[model samples]
Target: MTTTTTLKEQVLMTLKRQQANALVLYLNYKKYHWLTYGPLFRELHLLFEEQGAAVFASIDELAERSLILDGQPVADPADYLGTATVTPSSGQLTVKAMIEEAIANHELIITEMHQDADVATEAGDIGTADLYTRLVQTHQKHRWFLKELLAKGDGLVS
Candidate 1:
């Protein structure tokens, strides 16, 4: 006999995945913050830290949300890697590469948040849906910042 998952179960799964991703993404941002160099070091360092903090702030909310839904979040640090769709950063990378990687990560999270929010709404979990909606705004803002940094410019209107 096949067992079907309930809507609450689906929301719980999304919450757990989001919690894991937030932790991993926060660490990745910290890595980039520490390893950044070049002329933009100061700016990039500050930006990374700010962005990292914003992502980190969401972790507790996601975990608590799981609890509110009568589900357990991914609690162990060891499980983050397995549960998160957002991969951690490693190895050496230039400033540009770091920005690119962060932008990619933000895009991934934003996409997931959009889908997850829809699922929560469908499940009548308005609270979870609102959380995802708010969190996606943050990710989108970060992505826009990184994208603008990478945008081509010649300081000419021609």
Candidate 2:
């Protein structure tokens, strides 16, 4: 492959990493949606489903962008879960634990995206940079949302 193509491949890897992180979180959110029970059931159920949709949409975009960069998008569930840097779930966590895990994943994704954005910018990959910038903002919003839940307590009651 040419230099440009190599750069595109790297960008593809970055995008895949990003999408994988979101996918994991999305699944966790949906799990929380099903498992959450309390007075906040209705509120948290709707909220988690909404968040899942948002992350699901993001996964599509990330995969599309990878294809645009002349790489095959990593859409296989096994592939995503296999490669993601986010902590793997054992499906045993409570609702509050789920929330805390999502927050941590968001922070991790932000850091990864920032690094990828810097690399893309240095490589003159403006599209990748822009996409990663948007991703950073999105993750930050997610982190803020989770922080709202965490700030009031030890992340269990809120």
Candidate 3:
């Protein structure tokens, strides 16, 4: 007999994916933090560290949410790459490239969280929905910061 996946299972899967993405994003941010150099070295270094910490903080919350729902979080580090939607950065990249990559990942996470939050809400899991709602704000803020760094236009003084 074939068994259909329950709403809880779907929610759990989403949570796992989120957790994996958080870990991957955090690592990528840290990579950028360490590798970033140029005229904006100090500013970019601190900014990347701050954002990486924020993403790292959510990893635990996502994992706990899975446990609370009677599901398992992706426990093995080896599994993160397979589960995460966000792709990891590799090799040395230009500072601009790092910032652009981060912006793209943040955008990806923001979109996924909105969709995941809806799925959780549909499953009657308001707590999970609320978590996603709150976490999305962090990604949005990070994305905004990264985007602003790339903005170039005439200013009042220029």
Go through the candidates in order and give each one's C-alpha lDDT: 0.90, 0.79, 0.91
In the predicted model 3, the residue pairs found to clash are none
Give the alpha carbon lDDT tens digit for every residue of 43-145 in model 1: 8889999999999999999999999988898998899999999989989987787888899999999999999999899899999999999999999999999
Q: Which digits, one per residue and each the tens of the lDDT, describe model 2 over residues 1-158?
A: 24656666777778888878778878777788888776667877887888778888888888888888777877676798876787666667766787788888888888999989987887688998999998789788878886787687753444
Off by over 4 Å in 2: 1-5, 154-158
How many Å off is the CA of 134 in candidate 2? Answer: 0.9
Task: Report the error of model 1 at residue 90, Å.
Answer: 1.5
Give the C-alpha lDDT of model 2. 0.79
Give model 3's TM-score versus the native structure.
0.94
Stretches of model 3 off by over 4 angstroms after superposition: 1-3, 153-158
CA-RMSD of model 2: 2.9
- TM-scores, all models, native as reference: 0.94, 0.88, 0.94
Which 10-residue span in candidate 3 carries the lowest summed lDDT?
149-158
The residue-by-residue lDDT of candidate 3 on 1-158, one tens digit each, is 01488778889999999999999999999999998887778998999999999999999999999999889999998999999999999898988889889999999999999999998998899999999999999999999998888787323111
